[model samples]
Target: MITRRDFMKFVGGGFASAMALGGYAFAFEPLARLNVTRYALTPPGWTPGLKLRVVALADIHACEPWVSASRIASICRQANDLGGDITVLLGDYATGMNFVTRYIHSSEWSKALAILQAPLGVHAVMGNHDWWEDKTAQRNGGGTTFAHRALSDVGINVYSNRAIRLEKDGRGFWLAGLEDQRALIAGKKWKRKHIQGLDDLDGTLAQVGDSDPVILLAHEPDIFPRVPTRVALTLSGHTHGGQVRFLGHSPMVPSRFGDRYAYGHVIEDDRTLIISGGLGCSIGPIRFGVPPEIVVVDLG
Candidate 1:
């Protein structure tokens, strides 16, 4: 019954199965290494009165197999160490699909929020993922509300089409957050219908005055063109900078404006936009060239 030929076939099949499992394990291994790349932005007309160093982390997509609580804690620690006056979390915190529940159960997200500390404060906004996740719970009326409450408990100020004025060293600036474009485009029946209307940057700036530099925190970088002239700088993180960019270039960019807005800073007219590559991956768990980042803007 134990012929040499049959035994060989059995061993070969077992080896193939083992190899397949090993490959799967290896594919997801890099996600465990949570490293946040840091970048600095200094605008030309910035005044030295504030000397504010703002640290921004966006597109966290906190879920299993990608970003973990331990990893998020480490990122928070690093931001604290940098000693920035303010820390801004751009949106897409959850995957908002089948993985939405996974984000809900993420202990790392809660832990990460607890560790976030800044001299001024921490602020955030919702992204496309937030809408997608909430839409799933339209009938139950619990999904989006739960996410909002969870983030609030963590002390992150989620600004949806709103602005908060901040004063430092006798100098003042405005921080504004806009509703995600995806939600607006999805129309009235969208589950996250509460997140209607785009942010009125001009209206918000009117309250603060034109002289004061306004900093906008929008989830999707595509909103850059819509930003008003008074907005000196805008921070965003929806693209994940083409998560799997090849040879220093992304395969495809979903933005209407094309590849120029794929990643990093872009100066158009008098306004400046900085897009973070983000701290997590989407679709596949691999990050070949596009690494996660934490952007630092020195306004002096």
Candidate 2:
């Protein structure tokens, strides 16, 4: 028992709802929301009498209107207020979208990030965009990318297959950062399939000279499965919560494993990985369901 007028009304309501959702995804969520997500965990074999607070920012994709220097500075201030023992920049300071009003220079974004402070100082790792955007680096296939230079020039310690031992209040832990796994857009030959990478997890972990628990920083969570249990934690970004998530599931994740490492806390075979939803857009200026977030980890 359906009337034509009632059916028309139903269709109109559906159309309006669609438009509203589109507006929110395209405009509001990407530009308006910023959340602080915290995790407190005592990883297996964590050092006793040692506590560390880590504040991390990832996938800035800095650009006009979408992710501005002002916004970055504000994010820095807020992150500093969280009182982290160390602050880490998880990368992708370059613009991710093709459609943008104007591009923000690398120096501008890095300068904004320079304000982030911590007792252990600010450390950084380059993301895929950081490597891909540097035309010269890609052409050479082995040179310092602009993103690395930008972060380094600003006094941030950028790691590449390196590990450093950091001490807090008398206890110690090793902090390691792996080079981006997809540094080369043009994949290199690896048997039948082409592969992209600069990451060296085994070599990096080898640099650890002690039995101290390790906290690894990698730009993409794809390396999670390979991470050893000896490392207490791994922090990563790059998926941006698949850019559009719904009901805790992302249909289109950029990782090879799909939603397996799309976002948030992940534990596999006793190893731990924490992936940030990230603070900016990628591919397009849009976000739905998954809003931008800063991650804080308190480890003991």
Candidate 3:
């Protein structure tokens, strides 16, 4: 029942709308917008009378005009205002995109992270971009990277396949940080086409040596499938909510499972995974419906 002329008009209107949306995505959203996304949940088998307020900041792809040390410090201040019992830096502290006017050095940004104040302390894990940008680590296939050292230099506890126990109001729980999954990219030891990561989930969990509920800090959400129920919650931030989501559906997600782990809290088989939308951009200088966010998770 549609005529050719009517179809043409409809097509023209759709084209105009697309262009307008593209313009907004490229011009305004990535740089001008920020959000605070909060989640409150009690995981299955969570310890009784134990309450934890966690502030998670990730994918900070710091660069000039998009994310700078000053901006990072401001964000830390904002996060401090939230009064998180513990603050976790999920990953991607290095610059990932080339569209930036200038790259913010790891030293500067790590210093900004030192402003974060939490009772349990500030903990960090390096992401794929943090490893990818470190030429020395990629060349040697294994060693200390600049990102790790820089964070340590600034007094941030950088976790590398390690776990530690912390107490909140006399209740004890284990916090574990896994090594990045996409750490070694260009090493000759890598024969397969897929990424060669250095994460040791079982080994890291083995170090717990305690019966307290565990909270795992991983940079990428892909590990959620392999994580056992012993961990009360797993937090990650690498997909950036597809960076251009619309109507809760992202057309292009970095994860193999697509939108499954793109963003937000997901409970699968009684295990919980909270993937933060993250704080910065990568690949390109555009952001759409999924704005830059600081995720707050209240877990018990």
Candidate 3 local lDDT, 45-157, one digit each (tens): 78899999999999999998899889899999999999899999999999889998899988899889989989899999999989888888887987789999988998889
- TM-score of every candidate: 0.78, 0.96, 0.92
Point out the worst 10-residue segment of candidate 3 by lDDT.
186-195
What digit string (tens of lDDT, one per residue) describes model 2 on residues 1-300? 889999999999999999999999998999999999999998998999799999999999999889999999999999999999999989899976887888999999999999999999999999988888888998899668989999999999999999999999999999999999988876542231444789999999999999999999999998988998999999999999998998999999988899999999998888889999999998889999889998999998
- Cα RMSD (Å) per model? 6.3, 2.1, 2.8
Candidate 3 residues lying further than 4 Å off, grouped into runs, are 1-19, 187-194
lDDT of 1 at 58: 84
lDDT of model number 2: 0.91
Which residue pairs overlap in candidate 3's backbone? Answer: 181-197
User: lDDT for every model?
Assistant: 0.71, 0.91, 0.91
Ranking by TM-score: 2, 3, 1
Which scores better on lDDT, 1 or 3? 3
Which number leads on TM-score? 2
The top-ranked prediction according to lDDT is 2
User: What's model 2's TM-score?
Assistant: 0.96
